[model samples]
Target: MRRFKLGLAAVLSLLLVLLAGCQAIGGVDVSKAVLGTLDVKSSMSKQTLSLQLVPADGKLKEEDRKAIEILNSLSVTIDQAILQDSKHMSMEGAVQFSGKKLPFHVAIDPKTMKLFVEGMTQPASVPLDMQELDMAFAGTKMTDETIMESYKDIFGFLLKHAPNPSSISVTPVTDTVNGESLSLQKLHIDIRGDELADLAKGFLTSLSKDQEGMKELIGRLYDTYYPIFAAYAGTSEDGKNALSKADKEKQINEAVKELTSMLNELLPDYDKNVKELLADSPELKDILSKNTVLSLDLMLDSKLKIRKQIMDLTVQLPATEDLPIKQVKVRSETEMWKINEPVTVHDVDSSKGVWDVTPGEGSPGAMLRHVDRQSELYRLLKDDLKITHKSFTLYSDEDPSILYDAGYEPVIVKGTLMVPVKYVADQLDADLKWDKATKQMTLTDDLTGSKIVLKMGSKEASIDGVAQTLSQPVQSFEGYAYVPMKFITKALGAEGYWDAKELVLTIERN
Candidate 1:
């Protein structure tokens, strides 16, 4: 899925560049390209992908033809599109497989990055930092120069080396969209399998030239970007600041030297390994030596911008007697446009996460309101538990004033309020340590210097070296080790109250 997204993005970027370049060179207009109605569609066809490519009157030898037959199968398409004056855009896309359809859509404010979905409480505003976003989307150092440099490397290579089709044809046409008839230009391009294979072989051959230059470039890139990458990766070598420039350079040199040495040592066996692999997989060799064809069609407007594109490709799979499936077909289409008015972004309260929960918003009993209201426990405790940032006071529904307090966030599991032992220790100024080998926890109250030990899957605990029985055993679930809220607070010199009428257990500590 990640690769598919990246490939799609590349295709769109290529189209943008092609359109922009054509406009730059000729009578085409791109004044409205800054923002407009846009639509996109894409899909893969399983039927075409599995086709057995064969010519009507040709031999089947692997090397008999310069071009081998590849699958001329699969049928996929993306046809729906609507873009109203820049403020609103709507499109539907789907992929069909095994008689099932996977569909998705996109609708949002392009200017302010406000997202609107069909089934959402409200539109979501997306915030982004320019430098960080550049690094994330472009996959390079957090600088405009580095971002553009990386883009150049990608687009330049693709523009220079991508295979040239065997033929290209253009025609004029007309189509109706949303009841409006518009003149269109259509383009068709054809490519052969042998031409694609030659392109791939040429790419590999070019890598052998300027080995020393490539090595130096790699070392320089590593030395310059490693620290930035490490910061993004959330790793640090020392407690102090990052490495000095000299230190980073030294590390990069060592790494490059090691890599070069390893590659050189393995170079002698490279040809032999390739021969052995081909010898063992004759079908792979045969497939590589075969011929295939790809056809691409594009529909454009008067401005010479693409409105839609269709690709039909065919290739032959290796002959396998055991598999009944052979021929495969694939088809896809995309459309985009510009709107008159841009979608507006509404400002919203950004306060969220840890700071969003006030003194009572996320308290132990407070969260119950958001839980399963149909539960018996919810019915009983709905009005009995008092909520506060520092504690939950039950039965009396009162708050205990404290000088210093840690907070506890409570959750309900199996109709019971489960408190994390760590949250308790944190709120009451305590230290909690775990022993993995014994599956035991040791918690000490910093205020009173009181200590207790609780073991996993055990109902018994030791406090101040004295064994004590608990109402329920300590339990571990979903990577969190927990104990009953009532027991742990009581054992730690805190107060625990139970309201039989309300069916509530509240712990208060200061």
Candidate 2:
């Protein structure tokens, strides 16, 4: 369901694209008006979320009951958010857990786009350069207006092939927001999570067939990054670049062609991939398509601004032997006020102390910098969680402060993931032993006692005593073994996604 969950998120873009200043079903021209209001100068809003679980057959397993109990005790409120534009936004919120309201203040500095946080377990302020964070993988910075305008066509193309794109309904309505009665246009969507089976396969097939659209999109996107690419060449301290502007343009074109060619090579197997995915998890389609409903409602004011928003999802698990949980209801609502009015985001007083994290071994260490050793927040992240930054590094998840950065990062060789053998073993809490005389290494999972044995310079390995073929052989450098990360993670029942741009692998524990 993780793949489905991620792909389903694309519906958000479809929501934005549908409002690209177009006519509605009732001949209403509200889409244009609403789209105009997205690029707001200043605004403030409040949001809240609540979750509830429904048991199946009035019975719940111990773990399911515990999850529901925790959900019942937890609450969160987005007190308010202020922004002077897309770049400058600040939020204050509180999470009520264990009968404690843990207040936190977060702000995005307009000047540097750095994120500042405070009031959790740490008494001092924490500042992080968000742009440098690996999670910010989007190409270049663009405002809401720029994005919606530029990608409208691409969004339309994807939605055209998705199942029941017209399921979204628009209605004229008057809604009260923040104690103000106002005329509004409501855009609402109700979709079953499983209905997306066709969408997944259809999107891949449609895109592969539409060479013109793909080429146009690729060209348009590369062109949009012209400035970003040019800036790299222009900002060299030596005042001379290895690649000139013309060379950069040529490189961009070549990259686009290469990427397009790669896709072309793979597009032919879309059907095969889809069939395999379905065959691997045949129950996935039934569980989601029949038992999950995702709904979103947007209330827009006359100026095309969304004054109120609501999203609700209900997921009902089938009577599967493994998954004991039954149903989950998640709802979120936000009401807006002070639209376009002059406002200033809340700022933190850095006079006390500020932990500014850099990109290195010490990065996540700052999260626990000012944390009280005995505090709940400290215990939660440091002890309760197997903390690891995706496409980056992992820290010790034990009590006395978690693992440190591996010093070296993971690399992708010929499409296979290779990481420091010790890092993966430690993060997965597996025991690792190297046999010098035999030129072999063995990893035994702590929980299941499963074993994965790899021999040096061999394209073969044994998982749980079962032999398997590897994409590449185990390699060692400077006394450290570089093992196939995919093999280790999968063998240990883990999952990971690698960020090629940063040369980091995110091997997540299942």
- The sequence of per-residue lDDT tens digits that candidate 1 reaches over residues 45-85 is 11112223344343344532322232232223333444442
Write down the RMSD of all candidates, one decimal each: 17.7, 14.2
lDDT by candidate, in order shown = 0.47, 0.62
Off by over 4 Å in 1: 1-149, 163-187, 206-227, 233-279, 289-291, 299-305, 339-510
Among the numbered candidates, top TM-score falls to 2
Q: What's each prediction's TM-score? A: 0.38, 0.56
TM-score: model 1 vs. ground truth: 0.38
Choose the strongest candidate by lDDT.
Answer: 2
Clash statistics: count for each candidate = 47, 6
